[model samples]
Target: MKQLKFNIDSKIKQLFQYEETKNIFDTYLPGMRSRLESQKGVSSFSLRKVISYSGGAISESAIEKIDQALQNVIVYVDDTEITEYTKQQPLTTASAEMKAEGMYTSIRPGKVWRDTEGKRIQTHGGALYYEDGIYYWYGENKDRTDGNCTVWTWGIRVYRSKDLYNWEDLGLMIEPILDNPNSGLYPEKHVDRPHILKCEKTGKYVCWIKQSGEEACFLILEAECFTGPYQIVKENYRPFDWEVGDFDLIKTEDKKAYLFMDVNHNGIYGFELSDDYQKAEKEISRQYENLHPPFCREAVALFERNKKKYMLTSGMTGYIPNKSDAAYSDSWTEPFQSIGNPHPEDESHSSFNSQISQVFQVPGKKDLYIAIADRWVPDYPIDKRRADLIMRSVASHYEPEKYPMTEEEKREIMDRPMLEDVNTSKADYVWLPLRFEDEKVYIDWSDEWRIEDYE
Candidate 1:
C-alpha cells in the first residue's frame, strides 16, 4: 500500500453524530483513526463523500471544510482524479457478496441468508424483508471496539443484500440515547429482539421490541424508512399492561396485523394491532397455555401454513439455546395445539442445542417454513454473544402427539440432571409426530427427519 504524503496530523476527534451524507469526510475518517493510532507521527485529518439528493448551504460548508483539511493531503472524488495532491482513497460502500444460507446446516437446505462483508455485524433478534428484488436484514450490532461490554449500550444494526447470503452492514438502524428516557442507560430499559412490519396504509416501517428495565415494557416504534431514524410511535405495556416478552407480528390477507407474545406462565398470547399499528385491540386478546413446558418460554414466531396459522415458542434460558415447541390453530386466536420439540434428546431442549429467533417463509410457498435460531459460541465474550443465525425446515403436514415412553426410556429420564435436561422425566421433551385425521397441514419430526438431509 502506498502511504500518501500529506501535511495533515491524524490525532483529530472522531465524528460521532449521525449525518445523512456521503462525502470525503466519511471515507478518510476511518483511515485518519487508523493513522492516529499508528506508529507514524501524523497528528490531524479530515475527509468527505458526496451527499446525494440534497442541496443546502450546510452541505456547502461541509465541502469547504473538506477542501481545507486536504490542503495537506491529496483528495479525489473518483479513482481517475487521483494525483499526488489527491492522496486519500475514496470510501467503498457495501454491496451484496454471498448466497443466502438457511438455518441448520444439517437441515432444510436453502440459500445462505447472512454474511459480514468485512466487519462483524451481529443484528440478532432481527427481521427480514424483501423489496425491489433485494432482502434487508435489521438487528442489533453488539460488537464494540473496546473489550468492555457496556451493560445496556447496544445499537440496532442493518445489513442489505440482493441474495440473503452476502450482507453489507448498513450501520445502526436504531441507537441508544444517553439523554432519552427510553435509553438503555439502566439495565431495565435495554432493547432486545426488534421485529419490523411495514404499514400497509401509511407506507412506513413499524418496529416492536422488548424493553427491559423499569419493568420490561415491550415498546412499539415507527419510521418512514426501513433503515430509519425511527421516531417513537407509542410506548406502552401489553394489552393487560403486563411485562411483555419476545413477540412477532404477522399480516392477515385482509392486511390486519396481529402480534404474538409470550403470555403468562411461559404460554403464548396474541391480539390484533389497531389500524394505526401503535395500540393493540383489547377485544382480540387470545391466550394458549398448552404449547410446551410452561417453564420460561419467551421468543415466539407466528405465520400461516396451508391457509392455517401456526406458532413456534422457545424456552427462556437467555443466550443459551433450549428445546422449542411448535403449535398450530385454524383460527388466529384460540385452541392452539402443540407439535412438540423437533429434537427431544439435546440438552438445550431443541434438536441442535440452539435457541429460536424468528421464523421465515419462502416468498411464494404457503406451506414452506424455516425456523431460525442462534447457535451461540461459548466464552468468546461479545464474539459468543453474536451467535451464528441458523435455520431449519419443517414438514408440511407436521403435528404433535402425546408421548408414551418405553420403560427403559422412562428409567433414563428419571436419572436426568437439570430441569432443562432432555432426559428429564418430563416427557414434554419426548415429543412424537402426529398423524392428523383431516387433510390439514401437519409437521412430523420422525418423518421430517430429512430436514437435516438438504444440500
Candidate 2:
C-alpha cells in the first residue's frame, strides 16, 4: 500500500463551523450514498476520482497542519490516491444539496429564552402553570416528525423549567385518546391554547384548552399535576355550545376566580367560574368593547398592574405575522380602551409569526409576567415543525384621565425592533418593558432594555 499526501486550505476550515456545511457531512451525503449502494446491491462500489484542481500553494504553517488532517482521510485505489480534501468536498456538496431542498430549517432558528438552553420548549397555543417554586410548561408537541399542523394528529407535551430557559422533558402530558367519545371525529382532533391555574381554595391544578372548529370550544379540565395525566372533569368542562375565543383566567386578591375571553369575537368578555370550576355561572356574561380590538383579536392574557386590570389580545393570522392590540380598565368589564398594535413593524408580532401560545405570569417574580409565543418554522427538516417561545415584560405607566396610548407613542412603539431584523439567532430570550398606567400593563418592544434592581 502506498501513502497518499493530501492538504487542506483555510477556506474549507471556516466552512466546517457552519451547520449547513456540517449537515452536508452528517446527513445528506450519507443518505445518498446509502441509497445508491442499496440500488446497486453490491458488496463494494468504487467510483473514478477525476481531479479538476489541485494546489499545494501553502501560505501558512497552520495550513500545513490542516493539510495533515486531510491526508489522513486520503485513499489510494488502482495506484490513484484521492486527496483528503477531495473526500470532504463530496460531503460539503451533499450538504448543499440537502439544504437547497430545505432539510435544516426545522433545526435552525431555535428559540431565545433569557439564559436558558432551549431545545425542548414548544409552548404552542399551550399553557403554563406556576407550581411551588418551578414553572411547568405544557403545549402541543409539534416538535415531532409529522411536519403537519392539521386540526388533528398531535398531542400535548410537557416540560418543567426553573428559570424558564433550561427544560427537562417530562414526556407527553396529554396522550391521544382515540376511544374517548367526546374527543371529536378523529384522534387528531387539534388541542390548542392550553392555560393552567391552581385553584386558590382547593389547591388543584386546572388546564383550559381550545378545541378546533369553525365555532371553537374552550374546555377547562383539571389535573393533579401541572404536567397532567389529565382527566376531564365535567360540569364547567365543556363550553362547546358557546363560541369562545382565546380565554385566560385571573385570580383576584379576594381569592375569587374569573375566566376572560374574547366576547362576540370583537372584545373582551368575562364570566365567573364556579367554586369547583365545573362551569361558568349562567347569565354571567360581561362585555368590554373599548378594551380590545373590534376587528380581529385572539390569544388573550389577563394582568393586573398598579391595582388596575388590563387585557391583552393578539391578532389572528395563523402562522403568519400580524399586529398585536391591547386594552385596559379599572374593571374587568366595560369602558376598556384599545391600545393599538404594540409591534406593528415586527414581522413576527402579527400572528407573532406564530401565535401567543401562552402567557406565563411568573409565580416567582413580583409584579412580573412573561408573554409566551411560538415562532413557527414550517419549513423545518425531518417532518418536524419548530416553534420559538419569546418573553416580554409588561408594565403600566398611564394617567387614567388621559387616553391609554398617545399617537406619538404608537408610532414609536412599532418602529423600534424591526422583527425581520431583530437578532434572535443568538439571543437566549428578550425582555420588552411595559408601563402601568391607570391599572393596565402596556407592552412596548425594546431592543435596548434593562431591568431595575429591586433590592
Candidate 3:
C-alpha cells in the first residue's frame, strides 16, 4: 500500500477555530504542536513509521491495522473551519461555591474529580460499598501513559467518601505483582470492574475482579478492612465455564449475595455466591436464562429500588458512548423486563454519551439511587506521532468544559503528576440522581445538583 502523509499542524489550525477544540487538543495532547513542529520535515511517513517513532508510547500493531482498514487515504488542507467547537458552555461554578460553603454539594458529571488531597480520583469501572455510614469506592487505577488497554500497570484503587461528593483517596487496595508472571495480579494482565461485598456469613470484605487473560475468570480477594491489603483467594471463580467481562454484585434484603457478569461478551449472567462470598455456587441464569441479548450488553450496573431489582447496561460499543438499557425484575432469579433508555428525552440517547458503571442506592434512604457513568474521552491513536490528527475532528462537538481550566492551569491544578494518556486516562465520572415514578425510572441530566435536592 502506498503511504499517505497529512500535515497535522496545519490541519488542526484550520479545523479547530473555536477555543473548545483547541482546549481539548491541548488538554489531551499537551505539547503536541511543539513536538510535531520539531519533527515537521520528517513527519511525512507511513502509519508503521509513525508508530515506530512513538517508542512504546503508542501501540504499533493497532495503528498498522487501522491504517490498513482505512486503505491509506490521502487528505488535502481546506479553508473549511469546524463549527462544532462552538457548542461548549462555560463550566458550572455553583458546585465549587457550594463546596466552599461546606454545604451538601451537587454531583457534576464528566468533570475532573479530586480527593481531599486534591488528586484526581483514579477509580473507573468500580462499585460503591456502604458500611457503617461510610461509602467505599474501588476501581481500576489506569495511571500509565499508553492509554491502550493492552498495557495494564496498576491494580485496583480505593477511595472513601461521606456525603458522596468529596472523596478521600485510600490508595491501592490490590497492588500489582509486577515480577510474578504466573500471578493473576500480573501488571500486563487486564484486571477491571472491582466490586466489594461484605460477606454476612463470614463478616469479611470480599472483592470480585474481572480478570482478562487466556481464560477470563473472576479473581476473588479477601480483606478484613474496607481499605485493604487484600489477598487473592481464588484465581478462577467460574460458575458455568463462561468467560467473564464487566460485572457487579448485589446483596438482597434477605442477605443472599449474587454476582452479575457479562459472559463471553454475550449477555449479563447472574450467579449466586456462597454465603461466605467465596464461590460462585449456582448459576442463576440456569433458571432465569440470559438477561439481555447475547454479545449486545456489558458494563453491568445492578441495583435494587422499591423491592424491584434493576440492572443498567450499555451497548457493547468499546470506548464510545451508546444507548443504555435497563432491565428490572421482581426477584433476582426472575426474568427482567427491558425498560428502554432510562434517560430524559432531551438527553443523548447514549445516556448523555457515557456508559453506566454502577447504580448505587443511597444509604439510610429508601428508593434513592445515583446512576454512575464514565464519560470516556476519545480513544488515543495507536500512533502517538499522529495522535493530534486522530480525534481532532470528532472531539470538537462534545461535552462543554466543566471548570474551563487552561492546559497550564490544569497541570498546576493537581499535586500529583497528571494522567499521561490524557485521552483515555482522564475519563471522568457522571453521577446523576436516579428517580422512579409510576413504575418507570428516569435519569435526568443536570449540570450541577446537590445531594440535598433528593432529600
TM-score of each: 0.57, 0.56, 0.67
Q: 373-435, model 3: which lDDT tens digit per residue?
A: 777653321222122222221222132142133444323222111122233445678888887
| Tens-place lDDT digits, model 1, residues 366-452 | 334555555442221121211111111011012213333344543332222221111111011111222332433233443123322
Q: Give the candidate order by descending lDDT.
A: 3, 1, 2
Between prediction 1 and prediction 2, the one with superior lDDT is 1
Ordered by TM-score, highest first, the candidates read 3, 1, 2
Q: What shift in Å separates residue 319 of candidate 1 from its native position after superposition?
A: 1.9
Screening candidate 3 with a backbone cut-off below 3 angstroms (N, C-alpha, C), the clashing residue pairs are 106-449, 266-295
Worst 10 residues of 3 by lDDT: 412-421
Q: Model 3 compared with the native: what TM-score?
A: 0.67
TM-score winner between 1 and 2, please give it: 1
lDDT of 2: 0.48
